[model samples]
Target: MILPKNNYLKARNFILTNARMIERRLFEFHFENGTSEGVFHAVYAYRNSDGGFGHGMEPDTASPESQPLFGIMALETLDEVGYLTKEIILKDFMPYFKSITTEKGGIPWMFRPKSEYPCEEHFKTVKEWAAISTTAPLLGILEKYEIDIPWMKKAEQFVWSEFERIKEKHVFCYLCVSRWLTFLEHTKSQDKAKKTINNLKNWISNNGIICEDKTDEGWGLYGKPHGLNYAPSTKSILFSLFSKMTMESDIKELISRQKDDGRWDTWYGISEGTKLEWAGIQTLWVLKVLNNYGRIQY
Candidate 1:
């Protein structure tokens, strides 16, 4: 499958002209065949004095205050650009993570977002949001990058125990379930991982995640198409639901959705600043997903 040519180029040029530096670097690395080290360094600018990423690296938080939730975001970016390391993980971040570790050993989704940070009230005051989303991905990163930290080992225990507990827990959020499944993939087991994967698939299918809206209304809070846009993409939901047959059509529609400006737009929170950053991120994410799906021939 091929990405739209003129639209993609216009979008590319738009990104070059209007996107943030970090986003420009990501586009260069992913689409222009540029070095990932550029992304590596650009992301580092977001790194706080305490080692955790801040300065709005993830865009929504927009604070210099370091947070472990951003640690998950940072590690994801690090892995994408080939820069994950214990030195990177331990120097400032791990200590901060240790500081925030709950008595039960789980991390918080975020420590308060800075008062000046521009986002939803929910994000601003999401006190003690479940760490499952952060913890699962962080544990997966630690495992995939082979950081070998004791806290990570403990974190793994938390992940497993939490997942087991949540099995009985009702009304799971798609974000947490998605991350939990992600961690399970990186976690230490073939049989258990496979079992969890199947269960996630069944759960998603049973829960009606497949959006039936088929209209503009389906694009939820973030302008993402359908029921839940939080779990990476529709392709991901398809994977969990065992709906491989629809992937080709989904990819085609995704390609068609590329706007004439060459960017995929996301209607995020109130701030223009936040929207711009999120838009840049959406463009990079789209390119990455297309590449992963083997649709971009270049």
Candidate 2:
């Protein structure tokens, strides 16, 4: 079954009314024959002078200064619109990433915001350690584009070493593990990446990370990840990891969870504006995934 045309129109109206400019452009680009250049212009407005992104690029913080988390979000935005180019990666993203990278050659989960703007409490808890959560997905995106930079080499080494260290312990957060899955899917180190994926597949299945059942109403919300969280597209490497039944059930749940206003609810955020912003982002994400899975009628 596919999402009805009326439902898609409702979502379009909701986004035009309530979403941020970035998300609105993304929605149009993906579904309404919007140009890549249009989306690129919207994304470029968030870039700081230091070549990083901030000023609420992520909607999680109002900080104007550059942050690692926002950098990743920027990359994701460009990737989604197919505007992630080598020029941008090297001249813009790489320099910023190098500036903020930890001594271990990986980006930290976040840094304390210098601005007085409101942000989530977790953003205040500074961790003085390199995080594979951020680094792995960055590497994965680089790998997907076949962009081989010297800095990326070091970051890849850091990611591989971290995987070796964490192999013994099957414990991992869904967010971090999700990034690792992306890395494994794209990294040239096929032998090692495959071995790690085999080892972690069961852990991903058994861990409280994925919402495997369709009847679980609270699956995607409240910071919980679901099947689409891990495998947003049929082409994702994580796609083959799940059974057909499991994937279908989660897709059904996703389709059924749209609110009356034609948006999905976001569970984590500080201000009401942040909540609405994330709702717009989440609604676009859901529609994109549904489209990729052939569940949306054009």
Candidate 3:
């Protein structure tokens, strides 16, 4: 038998082993039994800190605390391992999902006792790129759990409308581009989806390998990079993998960047006075994309 050979196997093993290090505290409610907790812990942790995952919004790490998005990473890992379940997902994870929503019907990037960030930014009042990026993954999770939110239908409508509004413009950043495309694809808006795809292709062609614009780099939102704009993580890879917009050479180049051990270098901000590796969540996301495309072997 020809076993699948590539860096993906090594990456898969690395992820599997590191997954054990995930902090159980964040997931106390979900994993009470042998049931899978979904990605809630990872999601909550990442949002609680910077708006993105990885280590301190800088380098990549494997520990759960070190890796803020560990919940989502864990969920992806469970899916890859074929251990995800519906009951545990619904009972434990869905409650938090409801909490992320604002009274205005917009989802914030993170929740704090008093306020939320990026309250003013987004395509429409209903669809914030950061919010939708965080929420889109839950749609699949929700389906499995049989938890229905009528607002989700409204959110879907908002997403479709936003796609039409933005398809003609230059698309930038991984989350906005990826989530927009994912939403369009999932909702079956083939024409709008294609337009979104083409927009990404146009961006890649004009911007070259690395997107350098301040907006694309996650600047100008709060006059800083913030957590959402860090580079070389799931958001970046997702834009490349799912949109059907990137060139083959670009795709190959991205794949080539994967280390023999299955991790990608952190290309975003480096936190001062710290040396933590911070790309685990981003790396896992890229791995998921590769797996989805059948580029990685089981």
The best candidate in terms of lDDT: 2
TM-score of 2: 0.91
Off by over 4 Å in 3: 1-81, 112-130, 140-147, 164-170, 188-263, 268-276, 279-298
Note the clash tally of each candidate.
1, 0, 9
- Model 1, range 139-183, lDDT digits (tens) per residue? 776677667767776677777777677762432355456566567
On the 0 to 100 scale, the lDDT of residue 142 in model 2 is: 85
lDDT of 1 at 129: 44
Q: Residue 233's C-alpha lDDT in candidate 2?
A: 86
Q: TM-scores, in order shown?
A: 0.85, 0.91, 0.49
Ranking by TM-score: 2, 1, 3
Off by over 4 Å in 1: 168-178, 217-241
Q: Per-residue lDDT tens digits of candidate 3, residues 1-298?
A: 1114556566555555443234222222222332334444443344334233433222222222222123344444455335566764554444555555555443444322122312112211333223444455455444444556686775555555545555535254544444444345454446766766676566544554343342343221212222123222344433444234433333454566666666554543234212113344445555544543445554
Error of 3 at 62 (Å): 14
lDDT of each: 0.67, 0.80, 0.42
